[model samples]
Target: MTSQEEIKVVLLACGSFNPITNMHLRMFELARDHLEDSGKYRVVKGIISPVGDRYEKEGLIDASHRLKMARLAIQNSDWITVDEWECQQPEWVETAQVVRHHYEELISSENNNDDVDTVRVTPQLKLLCGADVLESFGVPNLWKPEDIEEIVGRYGVACITRCGGNPEKVINQSDVLYKHSKNIHVIREWVTNEVSATHMRRSLRRRQSVRYLLPDAVVNYIEENDLYSEESEQKNADVILAPQRYTCTN
Candidate 1:
């Protein structure tokens, strides 16, 4: 097993993170625990990949707010850290390119110092996703097959199964994914909890309690900002379903 400083695993848990929730935390914990159990790394690190530029995507709050919520939600968890690099970059970056760049940066940083005793580390990178995103892979536009192979060849990949879905379906479809990458892993524990950001936003608009669905800090922040209130929901209904619009184009 690699030492803690030398061991690096990037959890590409990127999303709107409109409000971070316990389910998100559970995903991180499970990934960390699984990697440790495999005896590959001393510590697992988490990186939040929040979308930055607002082109066609809808319902995206500013990156700063999302970054803050991510930081606050993971404040107590030592393994988790927010990665704002993607957000800071110029607009309309492809997902595969982002993944490649991130790994390159990681490698460059490890070799930055010349001290022989410094102990350089080559960390494994994994892109974390729910079953929904995996299912979307069948279509070419979301992520192309060649690009998928490139990502796996460059860095490790991991996924957590969504409730009431077979994760193996996507895995089996991508023969290239398994062929190129030796370190691909899927979470054995299925998350039975059904949590969705869309549902949470709608509930908030209806004045429903989101206590268990979101972290305490996130819930408080939402209430303080009056985000997703009835008026806000009405104004942003079109934006909320922007991804769905893309599906029609495909």
Candidate 2:
């Protein structure tokens, strides 16, 4: 496609980046490559927005630490950046709201720009996620129907194929997803890295080496903060010392 015909797009990934692992960062690269290779869209930016503490996911950590780890994970990336707006929210923000907020924020900035000589095209904001999240749509009441429509039908979705999940099957099962299947792109992970924040947390809890699982800076920060350690878990008044369960955030 010609430059003038190319659609500008921004990818927004919202999740509990508890201790942002390599896989988390890899998603952005994979999505960017898939979109650009399609020859219809040019990926202009990638934003990682960590869920707030109010989300209270089983293994989620403080937003501050998660935010810092996310920033550290993308220190060398040229296009990816972390946005703290969601983390700073008083209550947990839904995925749809997060995408909408960023989309509007970008438009506001473009409108206020003083440089008239440079023309800016409004970018299409797409929700980036793993197939696991796509499958979550089928869970009973896990997500509202209209919110699903707003996110997938309006902004669009770039879902990465994850192990043990079928994005296409999930999309086909739901009428809403089927209606907007054209807007959803399922990206394949040719490299097949199954590294996840849950596995990383388990390794850390056992005091195992996560040397290459995440960035050196993030690992070092976790060490310095004594996070996810047995002692740290015991110190938390809210955490119960269960035999088979690790009560630490990612």
Candidate 3:
């Protein structure tokens, strides 16, 4: 590995983003702030890769809608952008593949550089996730062991603890997570963010207000499109927003 100053950091967020929440956007800022504060890594890019329509998750809207809403969620952030590659997939793309895909793009772009003498180091790809996503990792058959190794070993994670979820407990308990603990950066929120897409959707189902929970642009888009009008069928029982499950798109 190159020196921290030489290496770059790219944050990739893979999710359904059924309706991106404020904390979704805040994760990038908080991770970036943590990296900068450490004087170790420089954040070069932040990409929100919404799961495709084929992800087949409950309450998941159309890929087109999710992509646009994700774009709107990060329109103002210069370093942050939305990538449709994952969403365009015919089936759900695993998290490891998503990270590798972006890393490959970086290498390809660097290869195209005109300067022959200049050597470019690939930017480190790290998944920006909430504690909920981390929690799901250990679930039986949720993620492949090899994928877990790549996700936490090859590409690391920056997890934001929501509602006082203790990420370290998960990290310290799991062998894979514990082995790659150095790669994981845990950001603890003194004031836990209780917001999530499921909560927003449930609120919308009941005709409740969701303002300030998500981006203003997203709020306007959701209203104009009249999304989440139909009551949730709760197809994925594990996906429901609860105190224990903080909603991770998976």
Q: Which candidate tops TM-score?
A: 2
Clashing pairs in 2: 18-250, 19-250
Residues 82-178 of candidate 2 have per-residue lDDT tens digits of: 9999989896677778888999998998898889997977899999999888887777656777788898899999999955567888899999999
Regions of candidate 2 where Cα sits further than 4 Å from its true position: 163-165, 231-250
Over all chains combined, what TM-score does candidate 3 have?
0.88
Q: Write the residue-wise lDDT of candidate 3 on 137-198 in tens digits.
A: 88866677788888889889999886647888998888999999999999877766788788
Q: Please list the Cα RMSD from the true structure of every candidate, rounded to 1 decimal place.
A: 3.5, 4.8, 4.4
Q: How high is the lDDT of residue 112 in model 3?
A: 86
Query: Which sequence of candidate numbers ranks them by TM-score, best first?
Result: 2, 3, 1
Q: So what's the TM-score on candidate 2?
A: 0.90
Candidate 1 lDDT over residue span 1-250, tens digit each: 4455345577777666766677777887888787777876644577777766553354556677778888878888887888888778665455676677777877897788678897676677777766666566666655666666666666766777755667666667777754753656677656478787778888887889999788888888888877776554454446634334333211
Which candidate number would show the highest lDDT if scored against the true structure?
2
Off by over 4 Å in 1: 1-8, 234-250
Candidate 3 regions with alpha-carbon error over 4 angstroms: 1-6, 231-250
Ranking by lDDT: 2, 3, 1
Name the candidate, 2 or 3, with the larger TM-score value.
2
